[model samples]
Target chain A: MTVRVLLADDEHLIRGALAALLALEDDLVVVAEAATGPEALAMARAHRPDVAVLDLQMPGADGVTVATSIRDELPSCRTMIVTSHGRPGHLKRALAAGVRGFLPKTVSAQRLAELIRTVHAGNRYVDPELAAEAIAAGDSPLTAREAEVLECAADGAPVAEIARRTSLSPGTVRNYLSSAAAKLGAENRHTAVRLARSKGWV
Target chain B: MTVRVLLADDEHLIRGALAALLALEDDLVVVAEAATGPEALAMARAHRPDVAVLDLQMPGADGVTVATSIRDELPSCRTMIVTSHGRPGHLKRALAAGVRGFLPKTVSAQRLAELIRTVHAGNRYVDPELAAEAIAAGDSPLTAREAEVLECAADGAPVAEIARRTSLSPGTVRNYLSSAAAKLGAENRHTAVRLARSKGWV
Candidate 1:
């Protein structure tokens, strides 16, 4: 089956260039494209594509949130992160979110196309160096749920509001927040959120 | 097929009560339950359910974003937004994201079950009052793409950055920002983003 793809990146210049190149593939079609996290999400909804190629940093939600959301809502459409900055923490988070492919932007368009196909076929591709580097850097102790909960509390929303928004009760939300804080050795969730954001775990 | 459901809500007290009630239905199984938006997403991945019953407000991501992500990636699993605040803009956004149902939290479990079954059957169920209110409130001038892009710019990302993030050229990004500003009659994209968010248009 031809792979229908959504390409999400903030770099419009590169995005267009890549989209044009990817268009030449016989088995690939760029069905939708987005420049920001929110737009990427909207396009994904509008397209329900076979695969999504996301950038790590966008104006809004970032690649991890987009990947997580898609994983939750669109299991059939596989996702991958294409980032210029291949931080170990980021790679781990993407993998935890069930991202099938992770690569640096240096890869040629042809390589990206093949990886998209692989992802659509329910396989995974991780940059060897990136994976090794992540291993060398050790691991982010926070679980996916803990990172997600901390990300939610990023805006300093009150615990009750956070509880309401996450569907986790106030106490459970606190537990996750505290756990995240403890894992990061931060004094509180605010510090933990900042730390996590700095590390891009969230 | 028996309906597998994921229930996402912050009110653990209510969530537990509802889960217990839902457990009574022989044809329906509460396969997973989540208390926060991120947890909901995680649980959905852990258990690919037939339907996701989501609260409108969750900590990590709102119900609409969650619905959009699911619709984009998980075509097989249907989604519904259960909100206490039935604002028209939110309803419209949810519907646009391919939410199969939108209802108030005041609904009885029996009624909620029926709606879930309806969604599982690939049908839609919007609360009559909510639908009317949305219609009465008229339409949001911004298209889904526009809303999404503006939402991306909410944090005051520059046009170039927004362009990069949205995959639009700088010119196109500017146009969208200007257009959104004009539509909202705001002085600039920043104001427009603020206005759109205030109205829940983004």
Candidate 2:
């Protein structure tokens, strides 16, 4: 049986390429394509594809939101999250949203087809390497405040500025920075930002 | 023949847990473990394991540095980048550093063992899902100046503060912020930060 697949990504070239790539597979058909989250959701609801290949950073709702919507509305349409980031938080959140498959964008076209098949077959598909990384990181060390602070830090904001925006005092911002540094055991704010970013905590 | 493995991660519990997990595999032996990048590189050089699983973020140097060291010193030892983040840039850099495998920490013990075995057997491994995400994201959208500005923003610094820290004029900083907002197509700085972060650009 041919698996009906819906493709959603913001990039026109990528979306077109992926659609063309999937067209080569006899068992897979690109039933719908979308360049944004809202379009993806609308298309999925209309086409009711067997699988939805979603980009997590789309405009409007994102892949996670689309997955939750599809899961809620069309249980038969399995959702596979395709993103450029394999941040543990994204994975955790995607899984929590009931996405059956989590694939990063760097996977080869051949493997992409295989994963779609695996997920469409009612088997859970996760990048084994990503899974290992998540297990190793254990629970996220980032608190909500820390995440907020780090997110601010990623853009290279200063303590005082972060404090003002977060509605905390300058000292409190420093404390948050220091606490985050201690938690990640980073020597400085730059290193902390880099580390947190690599871990997708920011 | 036992597959010798070197493990590197900062967390003591995770290091211990991973050691225990590897011990369960009959054909795999955990030769040496390091809690930081420098130690990881030193141990990897001293005791050449068949595979080195290095965490991307560490107290010093980071996993990419360790992988490069292993590649230079002990070419026989295959490097597997194991991290909590599935950042496309990280994966791209890991591969560039001659890492044979890229895995996130979320995989089960069985899958970890399987990837180790696969890499040790002269095979390359990457999480298919992650690869797809990376491809879809295309490349880092933030320009160097924009990234610098965003880094300042991550600290929740105000426009003037970020301008001072980044050595850009306040107007320029605001321009950068506005441009970043447009690039990520975000309505405001907060959403821009969130979107850039999800794509691992910052």
- Cα lDDT tens digits, model 1, A128-185, are 9999888876767888889778877766566887788888889999999888889888
Q: lDDT tens string, model 2, A1-202?
A: 9999999877553565566667778999999999889899999989999999998888798899989999999999999998766887678778988899997665767788899999999999888888887777767687889878877866656677788789988887888888988999886776788787777666
Please report how far candidate 1 places residue A29 from its true position, in Å. Answer: 62
Error of 1 at A162 (Å): 33
Query: CA lDDT, every prediction?
Result: 0.81, 0.82
Which segments of model 2 are wrong by more than 4 Å?
A: B1-202
Scored by lDDT, model 2 comes in at: 0.82
TM-score of chain A of 2: 0.87
- Prediction 1 TM-score vs. true: 0.40
lDDT of 2 at B35: 83
